[model samples]
Target chain A: MPIIVNLDVMMARRKMSLTELSERVGITMANLSILKTGKAKAVRLETLEAICRVLNCQPGDILEFVEE
Target chain B: MNIKSKLAGIIINVSSFVIITGYGYTLYPSGIHNWMYSYKETDSLNLPVSQYEALNDSILTMRNLKNGYGFDHDNGQFAYLGTQTSIACDTCSYTWFKNNTQTYNQNYIKLNAWGIKKELPYKFYVKNKQGYVRKAVPVKNSDSKFNIVDVPVKFRYNTMDDAILIPVSADGASLFDTGWLILWGLNMIGLLFLLYLFIRFSYDTSKGRLFTRKNVTRLKLIAVSVTVYPLSIILLNLLVRFVFRQYFSPEVVLKDMVWYNAYIVLLIGIVLSLLYGAYNRAQLLQEEQDLTV
Candidate 1:
């Protein structure tokens, strides 16, 4: 339950909007929303690679473990 | 939360509906009078005289046709007509002939109001000034518990006198009734779509993660397919029944063959969906374990 998606934090640090990041990463706004809101049950490595490539970040930057 | 669990839930819900609806259709057919009668021998032979008289007339006709009719006291041959057969439901009734000498005083008659088959098992002896006259009972067995063991008389429904009984055999018609055929087709299409998703999910998950945009789209499509497919089947059944009533007579439309097919199709769909769900779940679990190692 505490598997957090830190895409929003990365986006904020990069000073980018969700729409801009989605377009750059070649993923849909809906999927980006899924990740940003932590609604996704799990993340595919390929998707993480695309996000990292576009945002100049690593998997660790976008995923974090926290206590519920 | 998992895709497999979600699919399993959908399968279970749809399977339950198919089973319940199948029983409902079997128990209640439109425009048929289904009745069962149980008679206890009384001292006065309290029977419906008019119905018995009608049955006697039919028996006389059958006897005349045979050209070898006799009132042998030894041979148990007789006729009776009556609406006294109390059907457990409001739909039908039965009547039969009984012998006073026989130790088995209890007689039963079953009438298939839709199919005009009557069975009367007991022979009744009527005492008249001339002597004893034997009578046979006219009743039909319409997939009910009772059977009229003698002549087959046509059943009448809603003032229609010429109503003929069409013997309904469970295996006479096509296995997939029209409604079931349609459901089966829909479920097949859904299964194909699910298979596509399953393949996509497998391919994506094999690459070590399911976060890809294509994988997400596939998952969404799978969820939507599972939710909509069964709901559409139920709605389509209602639509077909409505159309059937609007365009055809209820007597012709309410045959068991029509709905039996639908039930079978639904059952098959449920089974396939459950298998698909379980298979996908196992695959996902395996992928997760691989990732953990």
Candidate 2:
């Protein structure tokens, strides 16, 4: 519940739409929306790797942890 | 995961279906027939009247005295005025006796008694030692004595045994019988429904929907049904006992194996409910994973 996803920030920095990122990373747009909204409970290493490969960003750039 | 689960699910589904169908085919008929005919006694061994008199005396001697419809009998001394309504020593305290007469409105009792008098007359039978009705007594009770009704003789000496006394017509169709059939029929329906739920759950698992909300709900339903199934049976037993206490003695339903089996079912339901909770947690995790992208 504490971890947050920063996918939308990275997508904005890359000048890419969620649809475009989903196409590049081989994930669904709905799933990308979930990541962008910070509602994802967890992220698998492989999926993070794929996302990083597509957007040219580190996993830390797309993920953040906030203490409650 | 999907293929292996599918194979396991298909095997389980087919096995369950076959077992249920096999039980329906091979065992249900005779079992149902035996239960249905529990009220009817056959192959009675005839005993002499003197022996019956002695047997009756011994039974009376062994038991204590209690009030019989408001008549008090002295200890060690008693009388048999007629069937169970007679003022005899209390041998029947082994079970609860419902005073059907006083519980009624006097006017209704009178009306019902009158209607019964006009309709099929009570036939008295002399019971043989083997517990068969040897002869029907021709003399009927005078109309003035409406309370003196003939009690049906019990086939066995043990008065505490449970008997399902369904008041059927000559053709054996009555309200009580119909209701009993319907109640047990619902048990069968519940079993079939449970089977369907099981198959559906297995199918969902095979389709990789094990942690889905739909599968969780299905498991909950199956759990509730399993719990309720035994409870329904216990209730039906109680209902039968309460209704037929006058004509026959019903065993203590809680003393039977059904009660023990019910506890097992309750355990199963609790376990299944927990399983559903676990699946719910898994579903949340799955959602998180799907969204992780």
Name the candidate that leads on DockQ.
2
Model 1 is docked with a DockQ of 0.04
- Runs in model 1 lying further than 4 Å from the true structure: B1-58, B61-293
User: lDDT of model 1 at residue B83?
Assistant: 18
Q: What does candidate 1's lDDT look like per residue over B1-293, in tens digits? A: 79964554453333323432233333324422111111121113333665344434434322221211121111111111011111111111111222122221111111112222122222221111111111223335544444322222222121122111111223321232333455556667868888988797888789866555456566656655665554554465445435323322322223343245446666666665665566557666754543430
Clashes of 1: 33
Off by over 4 Å in 2: A1-14, A19-30, A37-39, A43-68, B1-173, B245-255
Q: What's the lDDT for residue B32 in model 2?
A: 24
Candidate whose lDDT is highest: 2
Best by TM-score: 2
lDDT per residue for candidate 2 within B108-218, as digits (tens), equals 000000011111121212222112111222445664433222333432221221211122232233333344456557757877888998999999999878887788888
Every model's TM-score: 0.29, 0.45
Q: Output the lDDT of residue B186, model 1.
A: 65
Give the 10-residue window scoring lowest on summed lDDT in candidate 1 chain B.
B72-81
lDDT of 2 at B251: 19
